[model samples]
Target: MSHDLFLAAKAAMKNAHAPYSKFPVGAAIRTTDGRIFSGCNVEIASYPEGWCAETTALGHYVTGGGGEIAEIAVIAERMAKVTPCGGCRQRLAEFAPAEAKVYLCDDAGVVGTVTMGELLPYGFKGGILKK
Candidate 1:
């Protein structure tokens, strides 16, 4: 199951628009309801406007009526493991539980797996925004 998710991430990587960095990345997420969404990094001319693959995938999931990510997989570069960036980690923490599995992979295959909590300990939740 997760293997397939990783493959989806890899497939999405093919569509990345990273002309500047040349570091393409892809991300896939499986919802608790069993739906899957995948996205590739999109780099814009303005560097600050570029979006990470994980963030794009999450946007797709939400747009498609998915909620509560059961698991996620990220694939990038052939030689080294690439995990989601700090902002992506925070975005993921919003939908994934503390114990949700996050697979880190490269072109070869999955190199590591970590829980959402491991990536972002004490992540901010909705409670923090209550006024």
Candidate 2:
């Protein structure tokens, strides 16, 4: 909430590959160590083959040697207070704690905020996958 994730997400949104849907979105995730990873939506020719911005950011976060996620920020070119999709919510919940802040931003700045748990109250528990 106090970091530059809004700016980071806005910058990433400019690089989105969204020719098909023309809906460019961006996401930025912050690790507890203050590292920020940002990503943009990438759409392909196939309708459902494309991934969301949060997915790309998660990829970066994972490959960057993952840690506890502190917060997340998301923005869209045409929409304000844009939140992550369902799949992304689950993916984020895997790394981010229930208390982690999720910022919904517009072009200007963060307009709203929600915790990971609040956003996905009925989310599938990750512990079930542990063996």
Candidate 3:
């Protein structure tokens, strides 16, 4: 599963539309039922509308059909952990459980892994939306 996710993320990174930051990123998430969704960073002239790779992947997952994300993989060029950004973290919390595994990778492959809870300890769940 890790290998498959890594490949998915790597494939997505090849198409990153990062004209501004040049910091291309890719993300892939696997649903509990064994479906994989992947996306690459897409940047727009207006930074506010640009979506992170994680958010884009999550969107794909939801749009296809609602599912619980069991695992996430992120790939970037750098050696550092390529975890999701703050906004992406919040987006992930909505579909992934607190213990969901998140894999961080570079061109060479996975560099590390962490749980969703660890990445966003105090994240805002969808409780407000439920109300």
* Top candidate (lDDT): 2
lDDT of each: 0.89, 0.93, 0.88
Name the lDDT value of residue 56 in candidate 3: 85
Better of 2 and 3 by lDDT: 2
The CA lDDT at 89 in model 2 is 96
lDDT of 3 at 78: 49
Q: How big is the positional error of residue 4 in model 1, measured in Å on the Cα after superposition? A: 0.5
Clash count list over all predictions: 0, 0, 0
**Model 3 TM-score relative to the real fold:** 0.93
Model 3, 1-131: lDDT tens digits are 69899999889988999888888888999988999999999999997579988888988998989588889999886445778989899899989999999998878777799999999999986787685
Best by TM-score: 2
lDDT per residue (tens digit) for residues 1-131 in model 2: 54489999999999999998899999999999999999999999987689999999999999999999999999999999888999999999989999999999988999999999999998988689899
Candidate 1, residue 15: lDDT: 94
Model 3, which residues run further than 4 Å from truth? none
Distance (Å) between predicted and true CA of 113, model 3? 1.0
